[model samples]
Target: MPVMPSSAPSVEKGPTLRNDSFSDRRDSVNKLETGCLSIIVLGASGDLAKKKTFPALFNLYRQGFLQSSGVHIFGYARTKISDDELRARIRGYLVHGKGGPPHTHSEDVSKFLQLIKYVSGSYDAEDRFRLLDKEISKHEISKNIQEGSSQRLFYLALPPLVYPTVCKMIRRFCMNKYNHGGWTRIVVEKPFGKDLESAEKLSTQLGDLFDESQLYRIDHYLGKELVQNLLVLRFANRFFLPLWNRDNIDNIQIVFREDFGTEGRGGYFDEYGIIRDIFQNHLLQVLCLVAMEKPVSLRPEHIRDEKVKVLQSVLPIKSEEVVLGQYEGYRDDPTVPDSSNTPTFATVVLRIDNERWEGVPFILKAGKALNSRKAEIRVQFKDVPGDIFRCKRQGRNEFVIRLQPSEAMYMKLTVKQPGLEMSTILSELDLSYGQRYQGVTIPEAYERLILDTIRGDQQHFVRRDELKAAWEIFTPLLHRIDDGELKPLPYKPGSRGPVEADVLLSKAGYRQTHGYVWISPSL
Candidate 1:
């Protein structure tokens, strides 16, 4: 374990690490004991592995969450780089231009680097299976020689296409060997597939190799402190629980818009578009957490069971209710040149058949090449009907939960302006996290998630059934677009989105909550 430098000043009373302050009390003597974790990151040379994964692990090490003496990391990839090369790659990414923590002088990093051993192998070849097997055996031998047991965490940082092959190889050479006295957990990345059919097939294939419990379906959003706070805010706060349903709430909206387009990753973006690329896993997962019922327990299975139910309850979208948009001409974008592909933007009005959210429209919109960058959820309450303030200009009360540019939550309620025309005015009761809590280190999404995986907590991870249920809700709309039954609306780059997006909400006899909508000012 690396001791943090004593010379570095410590912010002892910093802001809370997580959003929620209230939690169920566990008996001090009976709490579950977490063991030392050994993680093996596949595709260690990849961008995600270096930038996100390594930094996250380093944070964990600095926080003393990981055992310094017992921890081991193996970097497996096709590249024939030396151990020092791998450490340099990680170190460069950590110290990259973001002004992160200083690089400490300690043997911990060197020892960590010594544990990293690379093996050359094809991503999808059976002959490489032997090399993969040898790597695992070597790790086990090294661990036993140093300590005792050999528990392993395998993270697949490759693209979606290689997931199945990697799982099959793990089953043949890794899983069976680690079963008896040790445990094996695998982390899979997103964009599981292009659509429902492919997703199902991929899920089935993965299931054959690993049990559902051993699989950690990664979605970095859930790892965010604010994202995790969604659950605690509703469940832990007594005052908010009564108003968290259809009777008190009006409608919910989730927006995930990026100012820039694919940014040269267009070749990859063209295939999945905005729907599969972001909405399928990231946006929907947020919706589930916001709308899901309180589970019986905080156990992974219980939490996921409730989420699956929420997804299953979502009413399937018909053509009349759904919206699609594609950004015009991918000229400079090499991913889709002269592309007639569907919109880089889309919005859908979904209703759930469940008692809690029957009438409320769960509006979801995600796009690329939009005017501004934002990711937020706004819950709009129904207007106070036929009230004394019926003559007021403001519409309704709303609660906004922002996830990007900052992490915060606030509510918009109508208040009477002093010495006004006996009328009401709207103002915000804001809770800006950065301003409210000075000098808080909100861990990056991957940092929190990697720690969760190390601790064997799957509450933040997605479940197989939840994935299937999500696919079920979107499959119909997916087919409509794929079969040309639904034509995508055209919108210019650097704009909010297609006019059809506005129309989608208009048809519902509603509009997006102002300041909550995706409006980009001239940059």
Candidate 2:
């Protein structure tokens, strides 16, 4: 494991003091001159690059975060394409306004596209990377950037299989050898590896090629506004500090559901099931935030250290505690093999053995083609024990942090009915972001993460040790399911996941909210 830095500056004084200190640091860092930043989007012709990466860059450019003349964008892939063609392909996905049609082919779009240039190349070939380096250097020289003053950022939007070869190629032929007084950074997308061993191997290989500070493994969930607010909600609020653990909390559910299926894109989904795709990285990361101890400070490494400790305390998942399912029509996809037993849904209970979370079950559930589309963290607090009121079966007081479709944090509490009947009813203290932030636009996950990379903040990115520990908790169960040829139960489209999931939650003491269904505000 890499050594952590000294504790971050103390925040116990007050929010004002901490905010001022952070702002000062940020201003100083942002003012430092790092000349001619070159952002290279590998796999530029692929869906991820066009749909997410380019759109994020365009938004940053539009907002004046990226320097107009000192920054350049490069699109690289194996497909032969012209600069105009590449720009045209990604223009439609770029978001230009709120509640309005995209500004496709407009003046702003054209201007943003002007900074982008395309280059076709093979992933493993040294000559291609050398050519890429030359293209980058040409831009720097034209801008009169000094040799040792420019920075380079490479975003790998490619498949995992090509990671090693591409990283090796970039290291050998593309890295800034002129010292660049600036940095070379690579942003990697996840499913970092299929399992623990492969993840460790990949880490080792990358470790040999680049320093840990230069590598960023991204999980987009961390960039969501509500997800980021988790820290403030827990540490800054005295209300939650006393009830965050096993003492007052009964159970916690971190759920992810999609209303749509793979849409014949099972070629990739079949290899790694929903567990690897969602539970292993995204949901688990959320769990860490929900359960981790307060960090020594807000520094990235300090926060990560607490997360690592929480993950380390989790007990191995028992076989009987897991439920896996395949949505109906999954195997019917042309890209999926007939005999494939890949799971499209999975729910597993993880128990942390540490004192704070000893008895509380942290249930993680995710599925595609489910009854609803939502991602949220639900904290069910223990029922008001020894009630003096006449309501015998009152609902459990719960706090929910919604992380998608809409962003909000609300608490469910029991209160008396307004009338003189002295009746009890469940009511919510809601803080829906849509209603609260009215016309303000929330930046997408990719936008925030990309900006973080530019600013060198690792707080929202995964560290190597955290990745390894996450795999350690899940790999054994994954191997067992594969080796045993565990046939997942089948569930119909547009329905909740398999019945087994409900049973699993019930056995672990979670009851669904009786009459509540989340309706998207836009809908």
Candidate 3:
């Protein structure tokens, strides 16, 4: 529908024209099959790689998304392990079926493992990468793929400190340089940087080596089924369009909670805390999707452009409107410092100073070791101006979109009670995946994101400007917490959070839904 500037450089080579339909995009991706494809995972031995990267790739292979004969999977890490050891480490985490044994499909697992090879190397050394290149070349030669005929997809699953060096090594030694007909892409994990300055520095470093089109800065939340459905629900549904703005809505609550603590991972959690870990990246991305204007078209960059506009409209979070908390027994873990003041919980109010949402408040709340494990968006609509039935104070007519613990969308409404006496009760018009799509399997967020990277779709990935805008909103507050200028309130492990969070919401005209319990569709 739209075309990118001819003079502008893209990470993807050739003319930058937008695909008009889903089939068109699929056809474009399918057209890239001139040679073999190499999927190299850089941090193969780590928890993230084993838990997410490898399992996702295996699922793709099992589903026939990756051509069995033309593809090579390489696992490179500092750990000195055999190929069998690497496969064994990741086998348990690969998805089989719910509650099914991990080793159920022995044949499929064997076939997937056959494509995988392991390389032991230092992250910063060029010679080690040269060895890796040799291994990749061996596969290319066997497959009879000439230079520039194959594609290389490098996934950086390592810690942020090693990103620049590892990227440099991949660029210098491991890239597919034959110019016949192929592309090189890199997928980078989140927490891009701790703050704006560091994020910009990292962006600059990567920019020097790769075009913006070639890099995929991923936010796994965008890959969730419900998160992706936000667009379709708002634009396609007639019921939601008119009531989507501040005029008809009261406030929005975006929440994330976990029943489990960091366990022994406090060493990593203590540095970034809840705000950086969840609020800045995951929750903010969700907010953008919920609040952004309808895009010009379904093209990747078109949707991303609207997301950027929404982020740019958001004013910085006021310090007074923010509440930070540390859960009790946090420092008791041996990995946590005795005097550490990092926040395990945070709630902040963000206001968009734009035409559609000027006066509406968007409350973002995230915490670890709280009362329950759930993530959802609650959109409360404004009260009726005049109502004759002044019955009991029923909850407001609100839309609840559950992101996890169950995937569903339900509207809370006041309905007539089934009794002799005239009264009202809160009921729901629900659409839960469990009941509606019983036999269907919902892919994990990582699986979908990885597939998108392979297809070269950027709609669900976070762009560079969007990342910078998100950092700008939270950087000042992050600095205050880091400097000890603002001390976090303490709360018990199983409690909701500091009492101030409730008060903050109440003051901002939000109803708590204290007495209501969410029922999952399966139950």
Candidate 4:
């Protein structure tokens, strides 16, 4: 195990990393958001708040998205720290220019820091939430904003277990008053629940407290650049519209690989394992976008309706086709048990039973302590009808979308070698964002989602029915793993997971492209 990351404590708190960045979801931002906005960070002193939540707010502030005068930030948690102390704690993490390389802007950081005020409070207490409400109301009154026309965004950066009570408190004491031109919204993070029943129950709890429209079940993966691009790449391109079906594409693979182990955060990793931690929410969300039918329109409900259909169409996971592996040294973390059955790696194949995706397997693979760190989607095309040059031996035609560690998309193509004699070799048509876009700054996922919430856009956030459909597909497999009916195979760290996983991939009808790798092109 390696030394714990400073933000490791929050790993279990929530997927602060459930966060990513996004842009171009809509045609444009339209205009600055209306009303005086009070952004409240619940569980303020936690790692998720400091690392993901606070940094995201600061970024939005520096950008023109958050008007400094209208937005007042508040931090609420059980940690009894002074306002200055809380700001100082998170000061080290507030840097500018995320993605590629980072440089801190002290002036922007200090100004953003001043907007934040801390209030110490327990999660389940009504009085505490009321105090929070008082602070927010005070800010609104001081600004001379109308009593009930102030936007209140409560960001729950705490654990899933306390969501019910925290939400209840928000409902009873912290809502925007019954006034025109103002609304209250709550943004909750993922790890929604351990499985289907719990997820449904959590949904019921939150649903009862607030209307579906007022809630944002944020999964940062949806905010990813590539994931957001899937819609435009599919529907807008006439070339792909004819080719993106089971008749043309052979199989699809959405994979996530982490080159490092749990370090000192095994307690959280052990309980959730790789599947719950990555596959259930992240990979599955990506799959929905990759495989779903084009929506009737770009409206939030329309886009999400298609996603739910894809999830509902998914056939149950086959035990014979599933591969689970735990890294050899996973148990070394004092937080993990010696005899743990948790898997650090998982490869499962999902087949959608719809007209477009029938018989086409969607392979989902995720792991920790692997040889690489990347999350990507690979679309493998079927063999060419007439292979005159026998290019199949070299590689299949695959479109690889690299999500991170350099965002790029390239298509593996068979090209004629430059020679007197006729010859064919595999090459790629590449689009590296770094080289192509040059200096465009992509909005971080949390910042974008938060902005969406204030603007009443649910297109990028998960819907209630979508969440239930997602859990339905994985609940059985999760239950089997919990009962020990499905145990993880052991594999060495820094290696591609268990060899059997490759066998599973092959069985799922995905042909591996050997002896060729797509490197993100540099200028």
| Lowest-sum lDDT 10-residue window in model 4 | 8-17
Q: In model 3, which regions exceed 4 Å deviation? A: 1-34, 95-100, 146-148
Report the alpha-carbon TM-score of model 3 versus the true structure. Answer: 0.93
Task: List residue ranges in candidate 2 displaced over 4 A.
Answer: 1-34, 95-99, 516-523
Residue-wise lDDT of candidate 4 within 68-180, one digit each (tens)? 36689999999999999999998888853463334447778888889999999888877888898999988988878754457788999999999999999998999887455
Residue lDDT tens for model 1, 1-523: 2122121112111111222122432322111123234577888999889878777776666455554444667777888887788888887665542334446524445544565666667776667767666766765565453232345688898888888888887777665253333467789999787777898899998988877767889999998777899988889989888888889787788999988877777787767767777778888999999999999977777888899998989887867877788777654665565734556788988888998888888888999889988899988877677787673345678888888867778887877778946766676787777777656567788877776665566888888888889888887777777677787787898998988778778676464544433222211
Give residue 375's error in model 3 in angstroms: 0.4
TM-scores of all candidate predictions against the true structure: 0.87, 0.92, 0.93, 0.93
Q: In model 1, which regions exceed 4 Å deviation?
A: 1-36, 97-115, 124-129, 132-136, 143-148, 176-181, 418-423, 512-523
Over the stretch 399-431, how does candidate 3's per-residue lDDT look in tens digits? 999999689999988788898978777788999
The sequence of per-residue lDDT tens digits that candidate 2 reaches over residues 203-312 is 98888898878888999999898888999999999988988888899999999999999986799899998999999999999999999999998989999999999999
Rate residue 506 of model 1 by lDDT.
68
- Candidate 2 lDDT at 382 equals 83
Q: Of models 1 and 3, which has the larger lDDT? A: 3
